[model samples]
Target: MYNPTVARLTYRALLGRRRALILFALPALLILMSVVVRMFVGVDDRVAAEVLGGFALATMVPLIGVIAGTGAIGPEIDDGSIVYLLSKPVKRSEIIITKLFVAVAVTMAFSAIPTFVAGWILNGNGQQIAIAYTVAALVASIAYSALFLLLGTVSRHAVVIGLVYALGWEALFGSLVAGARTLSVQQWSLAVAERIGTGDEITSDVGLPLATTLLVAVSVAATWYASQKLRTLTLAGEE
Candidate 1:
């Protein structure tokens, strides 16, 4: 297997220094919100589920994914540091795979872990809500990372575009449009959660089998396409 040194460089750049703060912020906010909600509202599973669903899964997960996935490659591409990697002997496809791996890990760590902790704080595993959403967060992390990693490799405005898709399309449109629910990562993940949750605590517009298929398909396809895109990746200018 031809390894990618570019991938290593991409990981260092994405995770190093200032960008780590953005990664920390999202999860931190989730935890903080959980604490505040617990203090004020006491231990209510419904409120906990709502908070975790509305804020943690809907808002924090996507934002962290945008930061991790796009930041993994976009800044390098923008600043032309990608040229050094492009000029190397490593396979570009390997670069994408490596970066995708890093992005997914980062997303999982930042989003999934905190979501689990927050869920516990909110309701202490009541009706298995914490575990259910945690699983959903893990699943969502993989898809979000792959999608935004591809966006990063291809677009200069990947972060902005990713945020818009995550926030505007998924959060906003999915909320307002019943049909849009079928296309949402949030809803898809919720489908998985619904199976794990007791009663009607966690529900989704899509069914378990369909959501499972879409989640796996999207994550795999996006990762594969991202690797393909990176093989033909063109560096920006020396200008």
Candidate 2:
């Protein structure tokens, strides 16, 4: 189902631009803040949890997901360059799968790795805080990539829409609104982190069973829908 050529082109499209800078900047900020915090407060599990959960998983991961996932296909569609790609003999599903893989990889590298490094630095791996959030970032990467990729395929304003969802739904509503948490990729990934990480350092709004189911469902459904959209896609001047 995966196409290496499409994956290669998608990676080039994603990383060879200014969005690449944001990818680098967010992780750099996370690591920098972790060092400053550790130097000042010393090691504390609660502090580690706050840093990893509040910023890394909640903010950085989704932001990177928006950039990577939407950037994977949005730019091409916007520039009317996808017609060339669609004219290929490859199945639309393969293209979506390849782009999804690229998006997931980019998200994981830019978000999850930094979360782990920052987590370790925060508490020196105490209470397995770094590991937990890293796992959280990893799973969140997959779901966010698929979700935002669908947004990219379906909307011309994919990046803007993605930012609102990531910042608004995830960063704001998920924290304050009790019901929104269940629909959040952050909460679902936190469920996995809750399973792996020891201590109160990690928690989730939903249980493991429900979170796992939703995470898998969202990723599959989004990818499937994106494929369907691409299969029926029509560009300007098409007959």
Candidate 3:
């Protein structure tokens, strides 16, 4: 579980100058909005739920997930720097696991912590809304990191695909079509939040058991598949 070297490299790559700014931007915006909303509208549980569910959970978490997850390995693979790691004696699984851990940690830092802060700002943690959504963000970080890390391993357009899934599929289709909600990461996460939050302020379309199952299954399957892909990854020789 501990791979200090790989973890160090992944953290540096993820929080590099340009990328670090993008990583922090959304959470900053969310907190700012919370402050603005609380100032003008005053404390309201419904508004708090909407702000957290609509913006923090729906938009910020997935986008940060895309950045952390794909960025953990995509850039290395693209620039052919991954060869340095692969050429070593380390197991491919170790490399994937280390990067996945880094991605999950980064995602939680950027998404979940800020979400808690924003939720509290929105409604003073009324009905335990802030804590509930924060839990959802934390749970989501794990699954999203695994899924997008796999995407980074297998596809050149990892970020684009992730954005499409996060924005188009989860945000758009999942909102318009009831069936799509059943398969959405956002909805699944909200299910967890629903269980934690008092009252029906933060409800989800999916049930708790189903959501928990999907979250675990997705995280495990994606991590396993990514390790397999990395094991057989082919690097082209310089011509």
Off by over 4 Å in 1: 1-8, 234-239
Error of 3 at 100 (Å): 0.4
What is the lDDT of every predicted structure here?
Answer: 0.84, 0.92, 0.93
Give the higher-TM-score candidate: 2 or 3.
2
Pairing residues by index, what is the TM-score of model 3? 0.97
Instruction: Kindly indicate the candidate among 1 and 3 with the higher TM-score.
Output: 3
Using TM-score, give the best candidate's number: 2
Ten residues in sequence with the least summed lDDT for candidate 3: 230-239
Model 2 misses residue 189 by how many Å? 0.5
Candidate 2 lDDT (Cα, 0 to 1): 0.92
Each prediction's number of clashing residue pairs? 0, 0, 0
Per-residue lDDT, model 1, residue 78, is 82
Model 3 per-residue lDDT tens digits across residues 1-239: 65899999999999999999999899999999999999999999999999999888888999999999999999999998998888887888999999999999999999999999998898889999999999999999999999999999999999999999989987778656899999988899999999999968988889999999999999999999999989778433321
- What clash pairs does model 3 have? none
lDDT of 1 by residue, 1-239 (tens): 33456556666777787988878888888899899999999999899889888888888888888998898888887887778777777666777777887888888989889999999999999999999999999999988898898899789899899999989977787656899989999899999889999858787889999999999999889888877776666432333
Q: Rank the candidates by TM-score, best first.
A: 2, 3, 1
